[model samples]
Target: MSDQSVTDSRLDELAETFEFFDDWEDRYRYIIDLGKELTPLDDAEKVPEYKVEGCVSQVWLLVAEDAERPGALQFRGDSDAHIVKGLVAVLLTLFNGRTPQEILEFDARGALDRLDLAGHLSPSRSNGLFSMVRRIRALAAARGGQSEPTLH
Candidate 1:
């Protein structure tokens, strides 16, 4: 598979793994493993301006949409913590390039339920993840509605 295809496949696999794990420890290990699979962000994309604030670990995100593929955002991210980075990677694979309406409609909490991940996570980590998703959705809305102010 090409790099992007592999990433998409890996995310599908992760959803499967989350479904299979019986315990949080196993899930945690799997999340860390997912972290290991992430492609490191390019050095040029790691500028302080791209940093995602409010995350306990260092997190950076870059968003772009291919002109040929309208409404789909492409995301690249990195973090100092392996597991956190993995989580970001998962989010990128699932939501990148999607329309703002789709992003607004996406039930991240529901997806977590499908993954069986929420009950397994530390509350703080879960909160941070929510924050990340909100930020992405907000960005999508901003770009999608360039002429209007978006409501939170």
Candidate 2:
């Protein structure tokens, strides 16, 4: 299977996983658990330049071209807030290790909505989530392609 299919399937799996929880509390705990699974970033990587702007919490994101893949990128990110970190994980699952054109073509907000987070997240948190998405797409654009149409 191709890497692009993996990205799309991962998001589908996440939505399925979320569906197992009947309540927001359980879903929230699951989200936090996902955050715990993120590969921790070094202190140096958390510098100002890597910090995602507009986030209520201190969030850092790094996107690098995958050494083995011609156009695909790998994402690394973290956040001070547990929920935000989980959100970063979700974004990484959706966008990481894919080409700029692939990232540009994915429906990220639709995936977020599928996870049922769109209306549940607080305004600040939701804004922070979009900020992360914007940064990821901006990185993709910088790599030499236009991003997908914005859903918001």
Candidate 3:
């Protein structure tokens, strides 16, 4: 795929990084560290509109059209749970700075499977993760001039 999308390239990089870990514990620690690296969100941004619906934790994701990069999206996300915040960081790494079509076409399930996350995550965590994916896609749809997205 010579014309690779940014989302695919970033996901590949993450899978390579995840493979360096010999154990899940180490992977979890790495994820938490990634969360720590996320662009901080203000308390005021933690309002209902940004709140992810399916997560047990208080999860928020904010999406915006990036002024610095035309046709690219920017994101900020946070979660009360450490691991969930890490998941938010993962999502940001995949979707941030991508164009709307890139986000809409991203194979999230495939990416998670490649990272060995599909089976490792608890069902609740999986649902929460997918919820965040849906939120990102929905926002992307709107940004692309589609009507407000309905959860698929």
Candidate 4:
């Protein structure tokens, strides 16, 4: 299967999982659980350079393109807050291992709506989420091309 399909499938699965919870509280628990599942970034990777701006919590994102395949990206992210870390996991599930075109084309707002997160998140968290997406797209634009640019 293509990388885009795999990412889409994961998103779909998440949507399906959200359907199981009737209340936001249950969903929040699920989100926290997902955060626990994320691979922790190295302490060195959490420096200022990797820090995501505009976040209420201390969040960092590190993106790297696949060595063997061009345009295929991987993401490592973390947050000081549990809920924000979970949010990072959600974004990672949607964008990681996909091409730049795929990341740019995917309807992130629609996905958030499907998960019913749009109304649940605070303004700052929502902005932080978009910031994460923007950072990913910026990385994609740089690495998706023929030239391999250094990821910040």
Candidate 5:
């Protein structure tokens, strides 16, 4: 299977899992648990250059080409706030290990909406989430890794 399908399936799984929760509190805890699974970034990698601007919480994202996957990119992110960190973790699970074109093709807002998450977020958190998405896309674009369009 293609890498994008794998990522998409994970998003589907998350959406399904979220459906089991009766309230936002349960979802929040589940998201927080996902964040807890992420390895904390080293203090040195938490520098200002990687810091995501326009977020209420401190967020930093690091993206690198996946050596094993050739053109794919892998992400590492961290946030100071628990819920925000969970959001970062969600983004990572959604976008990591995909090629630049794949990243560009992904509809993050739609995916979040499918998971029934977007409307529940405060304006600031929504802005911050999109900020991280832009950062990831910007990094992908900067790498000059754009792929040629394929004919269906």
Candidate 6:
């Protein structure tokens, strides 16, 4: 299967698995396994300039743009934490190479709920995930000319 197919399928599988598992332990293990399935990110992509701020773990995200196609962004990310790495993997697959409108239209919060991930994570980890999502959205908005007014 293509990366995109696996990405969408993984989301569906997560929803089904979460529904079947009654215990958080099982769910956590399942999530870890999911992380294991992530494709290896290139080492060169994980530079300091790509590092995502506010994550407790060492997380990095890199974005590339295609100017002719406004709002096109490609992402690559990595993390030291296995689970966090998996989470970033999932996000990269979904958001990468997407147009700004597409990224903005995605229901990331709803996807989290469907995957049943939010309730399992600690407050800080959840915050980190939100921060990552917001960063991607901001990048898309800035490139697409849909950015909201800023106080600066």
Name the best candidate (by lDDT).
2
Residues 48-104 of candidate 4: C-alpha lDDT, one tens digit per residue: 998988888999988887676676788889999999999999989888878877777
lDDT of 5 by residue, 1-152 (tens): 88768988989999989999999999999999999999999999999999999899999999988988898899999998999999999999898888887887787778888987768889999889888888887777666456433211
- For each candidate, give its TM-score against the true structure: 0.77, 0.91, 0.91, 0.87, 0.91, 0.72
Scored by CA lDDT, what does every candidate get?
0.71, 0.86, 0.85, 0.82, 0.86, 0.72
Collision pairs in model 1: 72-97, 73-97
Writing each residue's lDDT as its tens digit, candidate 6 over 1-152 gives 65445446756866776789889888777666766776556788777777778788878776678554455788766788987877786677567767776677777787787776677798888878877788777777877789733211
Error of 2 at 86 (Å): 0.8
Better of 1 and 6 by TM-score: 1
Stretches of candidate 4 off by over 4 Å are: 1-3, 67-70, 146-152
**Model 6, runs deviating above 4 Å:** 1-13, 65-72, 148-152
Screening candidate 4 with a backbone cut-off below 3 angstroms (N, C-alpha, C), the clashing residue pairs are: none
User: lDDT of model 5 at residue 135?
Assistant: 85
Cα lDDT tens digits for candidate 2, 16-37: 8998899998988988898999
Q: Which of the two, 2 or 5, has more lDDT?
A: 2
Ranking the candidates on lDDT from highest down gives: 2, 5, 3, 4, 6, 1
Tens digit of per-residue lDDT, candidate 3, span 27-144: 9999999999887779999999899999888999888888877998998899998999999999898888887877777777778778887578899998899899988998898889
Residue runs of model 2 more than 4 Å from their true location after superposition: 1-4, 145-152
lDDT of 2: 0.86
Write down the worst ten-residue block by lDDT for model 2.
143-152
After superposing candidate 1 on the true structure, give the runs of residues whose Cα lies further than 4 Å from its correct spot.
Answer: 1-14, 146-152
Task: Give the TM-score (vs. native) of candidate 3.
Answer: 0.91
The 10-residue segment with the lowest total lDDT in model 6: 143-152
Q: Higher TM-score: candidate 2 or 6?
A: 2
